[model samples]
Target: MTKIVVFDSGLGSLSIIKAIQKISKSEIIYFADQENYPYGKKSQAQLSKIIQNSIMLIEEKFFPDFIVVASNTPSLMLNVTTKKIFDVKPPLQDAKKKSKTKQIGILATKSAINSKGLTQYIKENNFSKKFNILKINGSELVDLVESGKFISNKKYCNKIIKKVLEHRLSQNNIDVVTLSSTHLPFLKSLLKKQYPKINFIDPADIIATKIYLKIKNKQSKKNSLKIFVTGDIKKFQTKLNKIGIKKKVNSLSS
Candidate 1:
């Protein structure tokens, strides 16, 4: 069996894991650094160091065939740092060339948008000229999901969706809206319903497909999905249940 690890700051990455499992039979490991809750608020240096350390820990414990940095903040900002620390290319990089219109609009956390990492990458790759980078922070929505408040307020949800759409339209008529934050995946239906004209890009598919290919090619070992958190275990489990993940969860400290 092949082993793959998927991680994010919290339950958001579950969306990625779910997609991957649908495509492959590899054992999966899902880790949520819930103690850190939101990686978006951290500075690039801080996020890079924390994520590097976590990767090292995961490697020592599971030695997964491949690791997916499912958090947008880390994926966009600490990608290079993580690669240097772990000596692996992130799966999302494989999907970059396939991007149409070259214009990428990212919906992520405030920290990710402010880090300018994705913007810098696009510019450095010369995709900046062709790629119009539009960014919107949806951290509040993450909170809503985690707190179980999203379902309670339809008006609030619509307001947020409208705001995100407005940002996309004002930025450059984006061809691709990258759901940069793991939490944004939970908003897929709403996004599609609100803005059917724009194609929403969730890196989960690309990342999951890459992992499946690697496992099929016998490039990585197989591992089981293990979840860890640093917050209320019951609350975390409730959120996971809400998202349809019924696996047992574990709790950890920083």
Candidate 2:
């Protein structure tokens, strides 16, 4: 069976995992590093260390064929990807192509929004000088998903979404917004409801397609999943239950 390990600071990993499962029958090991919740708040040095340690631990523990760093915060802030390791980045090229207004928005965590790497990445991917890229800090929205408020409280989620996004998106005339953080996709429905004209793009499917193409021939007949959390197993399990993930969540060993 093709074994793949996917992980992020908290519930954000579920978005990427769900996308991967849709196309491939690879055995997935999902690690929710709750102890390091909100990788968006970490400083560049802090995030570098946290991501390095997490990747090392995941490699030592699972020895999977591929490892996905499912959070855009660390993915954009640091150089973490290798041959087998994959990191999520904002899909600026896709946004540019789809954007009729030539104004594209990147809804990412605070760190990613402010990261020089993100700016560089945009410059590298964007071939046209005509397209304008707006970076919106979506850390609060990411918190909603990690804390299970996105599923539990739609009213509150809408409030936070408006408070965080409405003004900038409306002012910039951005027709397309990239859900740069894995956690942000959970709010897609609400975001669309709020801003009907905006096209929210999720990079998960693109990432999943890349993985599927890489291991399509070796995929197992059955899709199996194992979930683990690094902190508060009971609380994390409760959150998972609310989202209809009944699979047992094991405590990740230190």
Candidate 3:
């Protein structure tokens, strides 16, 4: 059995896990490092060490064939041998590949915009020669998704998306709106409602597809899936339930 670890700061990785479940028959052990919630604010050095330490600790107890860093912030900051979604900046690449316009819009957390992985991806891709990228720090969007505030207040969510799309990329003639942050994909519907003309790129889907190709031959659905969280189990469990995940959430900090 292929044992894989899905690591994220909060429930954002659940989006990735859902995609994995549909594609591979690997036993999944998901860990949400709620103790270090909102990884976007942490320094790169701090995030690197934190992620390195977490992986080391996880390896001591459970050995997986590979690890999947599903969150965008940590995925960019950490230099691990794991199979990370943002390793090649797939979101940015997809944005450039699909759009014919000279301008593209990227919505990401504060850390992702500053991370070497993203910065380097942009610098090396010759994106500037082809398209002008307009980046907005959607760190507030990440917080809202983590707290389930968007689901609870749809009106406010719509308002937030409108403000950035209308103001930040108003004159850029954005052909694609890339949700560079994992959490931002959850707001895809709202974003579409506000700006139906622009295409929205979800990195989670690209990541999921890549993972499927990696394990497609060894796939089975009978593998076990476990979820662990560092914060309130009930709240986390509620989220799992809504996502049609019946698995019980165990306390990770204990």
Candidate 4:
């Protein structure tokens, strides 16, 4: 089996897990560093250290064939250096290439917005001149997703949607909105149901598709899944159970 490791800060990465499971028979190890949750508020030096330590920890523990950094806040740091073990195929890259309109919106966390990584990725892709990029900090929206109620909570989603999109959705000029955070993809259906006018790009889908393409031919191997967290296993299980994840999930300390 093609063993894979998924690294994230919280339940947000579960969205990534959902996508990968659809097309791959490979085993997956989900490592949730809840001890370092809300990666948005961290500094560049701190993120650098976190990413490095995470890579080392996963390598020492899981030793999987691939590592997917499903957290957008952390993935923002992927571009600055050439870290070979893990990479994020963000939809923003694909959206910039495929979208027909010049006006585009990137909705992510405050950390992602402030990270020079966004600017670096944009310029690295030569998206500096032609496209008008609108960056929005959807930090509160992320909290809603992490709260484990966004799916069942419509009124809350609607209110947050308005707070997030009403002003921008009113404009006819924008064509695509990239949900840069992995957490944001879970709310795409709700967003689409409300505003059918603009297209939403999710990095989770893009990353999952890429992973499938890489491991699709390796089905001859057996598949397995294990989840790890730096915090309470019961709490993680409770959150996952709310979303129908009833399987056994162990804590890092376990």
Candidate number of the best lDDT: 2
- TM-score list, all predictions: 0.81, 0.98, 0.89, 0.89
Q: What C-alpha lDDT do the candidate models reach, one value each?
A: 0.68, 0.90, 0.75, 0.76
Sequence-dependent TM-score of model 3: 0.89
RMSD of 1: 3.8
Can you tell me which runs of candidate 1 are displaced by over 4 Å?
Answer: 80-104, 128-131, 150-152, 167-172, 217-224
* Residue 196 displacement in candidate 4 (angstroms): 0.9
Clashing pairs in 2: none
A best-first ranking of the candidates according to their lDDT comes to: 2, 4, 3, 1
Q: Tens digits of per-residue lDDT for model 4 on 40-128?
A: 77887888788888878888887778888877777786542233345553466677776687778888888888888888777777775
lDDT of 2 at 116: 95
Give the top-scoring candidate (TM-score): 2
Q: How far is candidate 3 from the true structure (C-alpha RMSD, Å)?
A: 2.4
lDDT of 2 by residue, 1-254 (tens): 89999999888888999999999898999999888888998899999888888888888888899999999988898998888999999888788789999999999989998999999898889457888888899999998988889888999999999999878987898999999999989899999999999999999999999999889999999889999989899999999998999999998865
Model 3 residue 144 distance off true place after TM-score fit, in angstroms: 1.6
Candidate 3 Cα outliers beyond 4 Å, as residue runs = 82-90, 221-223, 238-246
Per-residue C-alpha lDDT of model 3 across residues 68-116, encoded as one tens digit per residue: 7777777666666545322324477677788887688878788887777
- Number of the candidate with higher lDDT, 1 or 3: 3
RMSD over all Cα atoms, model 2: 1.0
Q: After superposition, how far is residue 129 of candidate 1 from its true place, in Å?
A: 4.2
For each of the candidates, the C-alpha root-mean-square deviation to the true structure, in angstroms, is: 3.8, 1.0, 2.4, 2.4
